[model samples]
Target: MLPNTLAQEMPRALQHLLAREEQTDMTTLPRRSFLKLAGAGGLALGLYPSLASAQAPAAAGLKPFEQPTAFVQIAANGDVTVTINRLEFGQGVQTALPMILAEELDADWAKVRSKHGSNNPAYADPLFGMHLTGGSTAIKHSYTQYRELGARARAMLLTAAAARWNVDVKTLRTQAGWVLGSGGRKASYGELAEAAMSQPVPEKVTLKNPKDFRIIGKPTTRLDAKAKSSGRQNFGIDVQLPGQLTAVIARPPVFGAKIASLEDGAARAVPGVKTVLRVPLDRGAEGVAVVAEGYWQAKLGRDALKLQWDTSGVEKVDSEKQLAQYRELAGQAGPRHFDADMAPLANAPHTLEAEFVFPYLAHAPMEPLNCTVQIGDNGAELWVGSQMPGLDGMAAARVLGFKPEQIKVNVQTAGGGFGRRAIATSDYVVEACTIAKATRAAGFNVPVRTLWSREDDIKGGYYRPMHLHRARIGFNAQGQVLAWDHTLVGQSIISGTFFEGMMVKNGIDATAIEGMREPYPLPMRLTVHHPKQNVPVLWWRSVGSTHTAYVMETLIDEIARATKQDPVAYRMKLIGDKHPRHRAALQLAVEKSSYGKKALPQGRAWGVAVHESFSTVVAYVVEASVKEGKPVLHRVTAGVHCNLAVNPRTVEAQIQGAALMGLATCLPGAAITLKDGEVQQSNFGDYAVPRITDMPQITVHVVPSADAPTGMGEPGLPPLAPAFANAIARLTGKTPRELPFKLA
Candidate 1:
């Protein structure tokens, strides 16, 4: 069942999405139509074999590098299929990416559909040289790659049409999937695909100018919106195969704990229970896998098992103790991120010292972690919603003792990931492969689907590390910051991962300090401390910006209030004229929201905040009031500057969704904590996520620009909480130092 957090879409939006998904029975188009063309002498673009090549070499093979020229396909029936190289996960890449390709192809928009690409080498991120999607880099990195692909395909079709009509290539123009030559010669891309595939691949192609773009910056609707709403879209969790068995694991209560004793009598007695096996789990924790005919039985079998765990030598983290230690660490600066003299603090006329605490956050994607693995003599096949398919596939090959080329990974659509689906260790994928390998060793050759129940998912680790921030600022009555000193303490997400070498330097993880004092050029000293902890940690949405932006923006607002200056005007002064994008975004929000001029309802006040993450700037003007001793956010108006919106509709949706998730951060029970090393919160019942009623009235507006687009998935989130807090502060006359506001 989908979480209420995700199902809170407006009635009309839900109707549209459900209607589309209901009409479509499956996620993928009928490959038969294109496969039937295999024996024909026609071109079949972007085709991947259903299985690993039978001719795979005994050792590592060049076959591992081969991929279908496989992004755009035109069928003889004039259907255009565009392949998206990254996971969708509700970010709209499935729609925006296809729009980019179809725009360059000049294909008829109505004839275009999209397909999710797997771990094939051709689908690797163009800039990163890996099959991964995170850091909001999908569109930023692939914008040109897809455009070039479409242009090349379009160029080939134009050449074919020109040859067919015996006209100069320059004299031919393409529009609406048709190549028109001089003297009124015209042919559909489908009719020319075969001949075009045989033409010499163009070494260079001219891209369409921004002025000529018809689809790039348009307010296009999402292609998969309907399917997702209708429940016809098959996310990774919805996959079912014949003879497939569901497997659930009974994990240790403590991280890195080993099983001392286990009793499987009750578990094996459960109806539909097939077999039980011991499996190697991630982080050196041992677990028992219960395989059954269905998920419910597997879950029941897991519940029935009695296992004794040995937690010796494992750190039992208590949240209260950790916070106390972090607070002590913050008082004493350790490593410096910025070198600035704070000598003026001693003599400054006015000063403020504040401490902020942020708890660990669960990504809690709508669909819990799931992976299906099937091992065969020739090769192994895996189906998953993998953000890094190549990485996961390689990990599977290593675990199964097969060559990389012998493993085939089929990437599936995901409900939502934030940052959970992409991991350097490929933790969940490896766990599934381990279970499958154990099942095979136990004499079961059937497909094994590893599923995580909502409890297992919430208790599972890899959360946003808890953070503490201490800031000391000295400013005059004019709001000019004379001195600033900041200290941050937290666990480093990249410390033990493969990316540690590149992402961590000088005792600082790059992601850990991304949104620190920037758009405002203030002379300040910033220091950090990274403590090793037993809990696993990963990036959550906006990464460090999640906490940093809140600290920076809220403190800035405090400075404005201290100086008796309008928050918006003070922010503009600090932003200066250097960052036009930030300035423009803030100004636009101010104007659209009528920040100073609009009359608010009695007891309501306006709040403002602006932040930039992943190169995208967003500003929010919000209205809030205190109702019955609780903060009530009534409405929000957002101004986004992602340069050119690939699909305005998608940008709007991302902001609205991200804002809600941001609001979730300020709601009661919106945190993950540990007691005796075990996760205390284990579902929506205890771990709060915003319901439909919690959502504020939102209006999203984008600054029109012809520049290249930036990321939208994360930028909208960083400003929401601070804007709400700023409004609440106006009424309470007190600063909010902790999350889930404790009003007095």
Candidate 2:
């Protein structure tokens, strides 16, 4: 439930718009007559002469700036406001989405303002049926709709200008918010604002061709770059509301443990401590929150408290033990399978089989998880950076025993999501709500803001589950690959109660079986999934593709080695020649990296890997050398096939960022585990991320196509790990089957 003030303010804000509309004389008038009347009304109301020039409305009485997904409003003072409904979580969506709309509207970019829209079905994505942003689908989903929106507004403005000047719209063109006629008569959009506002929306709007686009494909700087660089951009951790108290929780030491009792004598005596309460942990997890005036005080209070935990069930859970169990499971023949064949090879052929292991990983976002909740008599108000607002709203409503409408979720910019922010049950948000409710029950009227320390966040169990993959491939004497058999042992991403009804036939989780079932043209390819139930796992950056791509690409390298053929040539042979983009990326990466030319000094070698994910094809040529028993990356040359980039600069940045992130993860970073199911690595001092000194010189090449824009965020990540592993194998003459590859 949201605070009464915010809940009460919403209807008033909506009613204000309705009242403003009712004040206008909106009786049915012909399109032409409506514009003339609006222009006359503007002139009579003492509007600037620049705003009194325009013609009539379009058919159906549609307004110029109205859009199904977003709306644009132009004020009399030349302020152009564009509303975006999608969440911007370090993906540059705040800048990119508006660029599409502003390019079509021909609005002055310098004067444009971006605002986030409320959660409504009007803003729902047509493909997903929800107003959500994930799976790298932001730009791809809104590309066409935003363009149409901008084009419609442009047409209406042009129509209004033609009517005012008694000239044909065909002879007029718009640029920088001004409409210009054949003879050089020019009128600013503000001059034609009222008449344009009265114009009807176009039934069929044509989009600009690629060559004619001045802004869509250009490399414009990110709109929020300045704010972010100047430390003014507010993420979830930076949110602070009036009279908001801070809170910190003490969680159990083991998974699924229960809290026995708490000795809060020291916590209650801590300075600035407001309240210490033992709240029931959601989802059967253990924790107690300590509320205080500030985060430091809350932390001190939480640390001072003594608590006992009952770790009866999960005391023996260990990663090494889990890995051994998974290996045992992978050895068994499974009935629930997709595209897999585990039988012995039939014809005269060469076969290669190996098992790969990937450890569990944590998201470890920079800002950590934080949320501010204020519950009042009317409803509940929550200020947080949530990836799934609807889901968060429902969860808050359920905990507070109120209707979903009673909760108001104020979405904020996230430091980084990477699927961590979409936790079905937000522990931070729920804790804050509970604190607020507890305070209200105590007659204190104080809201609570829960903040999870970096340690707390790292210890949470929303990790990318450890996976075991066993694979075998057979190649004929002609060097043609004939059969592929793969079995994956990992936790099901969609098996939990939250996703109870989303399971497909035989309870197969598509996320866990992503890259295992490729669409390649193979003679006999079989993939099987053996779901592991004990460990808790969730989606990470690339989801299943993260490990699956590594396994598949590494297996291909092994096949190429056995066939005694060039790796690039072998992959090119297997892939379809008709896929020009895929072939082009492969060719470019190989040619640029001098794939088969020569080996570098110091026993260095280069390895090539190509993969397609998120509708984008990418190829990587990684150069590596074993120096003093350590794999040192020298250079990485990549070719990216992202169809029709909305912003080429953003696409390049995303590729560069993804490559660095993948390199960091590939080098050495997994959530280290203890024998009692507790995380050992808790902070950056122990958990390493890629630094400037460790970065290799990276070259990214984009293969352009006029095809629709595909995903750019995760596609660049899938190739790095496998490419590096193949390079390591070539250098050491041993297959690097496990992640966090260590050289001997």
Candidate 3:
């Protein structure tokens, strides 16, 4: 079955090549037939090259190079369709990836449309050879791959035009979907599509110089902007197939708790309720599913169900108790990430010790989790806003007792993910598949759409791990660091996962200590403790950088103030020109924000912080004030150094959105707390995310560079909180020791 599917997966270019290879006498073929079927005429939808791994070596009776069938497609109407390998969860890859391919194809941008890809092996990440969209790597990894695809497609079209015009291909150039020949003879790509199918796929082509770029690096609007703005864009939550049933699960209130007994008499009596059954949940837990005709009915049935839970062995994590445990752990050193002698701390001229606490945070994507699963005799199909479709598909296969290839996972456009959609556990997908399997067992032949209400999503186990940082610093009178010892205590997000082998070493998770003691030459000793907690924790937006950056930047500012030196100037001196990117980004923000040149309004202070995460450096200079004992961030000026911004508009939007989320950390009710082993906050009423009223006046500036672009999505967030803290500290003359600063 897999072998037959592999053959069907070949792209049009490879199909034509394979057909030519089978011909014994080429001269016997008709001339018109050669012209029509030689290249890509009538290229079937599934005719693109097979997965890169499936395309064996030339010695293995397969092509030496994989073809570009999965990514690029040209319709008869001249609409250029480019398939994005990454999920478009508000990061603008739908527009940016198309821009990359269209720029090289010389296709009319106005005619370009983007599509989200599925779990095809061909859509795997170029670097990891897996389906993923996290670490902000969508653009960074696929930039060259997409460009080459466009170039290859354009070369084929040009060859066809040259043949039709009876001229050398070298004399033809493409522009805006047209091939121009000498003496103004031109042909639209649509007119040459049938003949161009015969052109050989080029293994190598010259990429355009940055100076010659007409589309990339320009500020282009998002391709899905109109559809999304007009409320026509279909998200995973919006998927409604025929004969589909809605499912709502009633999970245990305590993490890892199981249902001991159930009473579903009233639930089954509901008007549209179909059946109620127990199912397996993530992390060895159990849940009850309420299947019905629609979401509202399923939800009502779920609310009507009565059950008894057994949480005897489960750990009931209390936020206050957890903080006490962390403080005790911080007092003793754990495994060391960096080693330095602490002898200087005993007799240092100036010393400061501070402990910072950060609580768990929910991803709270605008669209709560949902997965639509359709089961048939031969296989099953899944539709979800998946960041890791390959993993999700495999999980579904396991749940349904089918082969991995038997399940098709369709990645859908999402409202926002941050880092929740991409999980090591594939929890949501598995839950959906479980419900589907149970529905089938109950003799229901309809598709099952599992939906998570906002309350369920917020209370879900996977969250950004709560963290505690203890820093003991000793510095000279001039703000020169003498010795720094830092201890971090948090649950290991990758300790027992599949990524542990690669991401964890020496009992320390690299993600737990990513942004420590860099860009500044501090003789620092860093220690980390990974406590096994019942709570499920995953990487947040910027991972460890979220808290590490805040701790480092705020402490540095405090040391500068103690020594009576300008904060920005002290930062420059410590930076010492080793990291030019950090320096440039910081300088740009200071210059653009007029940090020292202009006087701020009374009661307002300028706060500055800079940090690098995901290979991008971001600096924020903000105006903040303490109004009635609450910190209010008035305005923000950001200098971003993500190298070349593929689309400045996307970059700006990302920075603005990320900055707003960062401000959310400073607002009152931002932290997720656990009481008696249950998530205390279930919805926005208690878990406060930033509203439009909390937004500040923001200006984002990009440093001009031709260097390859890094990630922009997560970098903007890590600095905003620290910058705001620095401003509030100036007004109160006291440092903030925890998130959502407590001022009395």
- Most TM-score-accurate candidate: 3
Cα lDDT tens digits, model 3, 36-106, are: 32232211213222353322111221121124556777788888888899999998999999999999999
- What are the runs in model 2 whose C-alpha is more than 4 Å off? 1-69, 159-172, 182-185, 190-199, 313-316, 339-348, 497-503, 517-519, 523-534, 597-599
lDDT of 1 by residue, 172-270 (tens): 899999998766778998999878766655546688998998888889988987987887889888889889999999999988899999999999999
Q: What TM-score against the true fold does each predicted structure earn?
A: 0.91, 0.87, 0.92
For 1-744, candidate 2 gives per-residue lDDT tens digits of 223322222211001111111221111223443344233221011111111224344456433223422366777766677777577777777878888888888878887777665443334443333345666767776787677778888898899999999988999998888888987799887788778878776857888887777778888888888989999988878877788788888988776788877899999899988888777665577678788999999999998989998877654467778788888887776646455343545553788778888877878888898888888777787888877665566567767777666677777888886888766556566767776787667566877888889988787767887788887677776566666666788876656534333333365565666665343565444444555544456778877788878887887788788777788888877776656777888888887877778667767788788877766788999898777787778899988888888888888788777877777766766445556577777887766777797788888888878876877777788889889889888878887888777665
Better lDDT candidate (1, 3): 3
Runs off by more than 4 Å, candidate 1: 1-68
Could you give the candidate ranking by TM-score, starting with the highest? 3, 1, 2
| Backbone clash numbers for all candidates listed | 6, 18, 11
The predictions' CA RMSDs to the true structure, in order, are: 9.8, 10.6, 9.4
Q: How far in Å is the alpha carbon of 307 misplaced in model 1?
A: 1.4
Full-model lDDT for every candidate: 0.83, 0.71, 0.84
Task: List the lowest-lDDT window of 10 residues for candidate 3.
Answer: 9-18
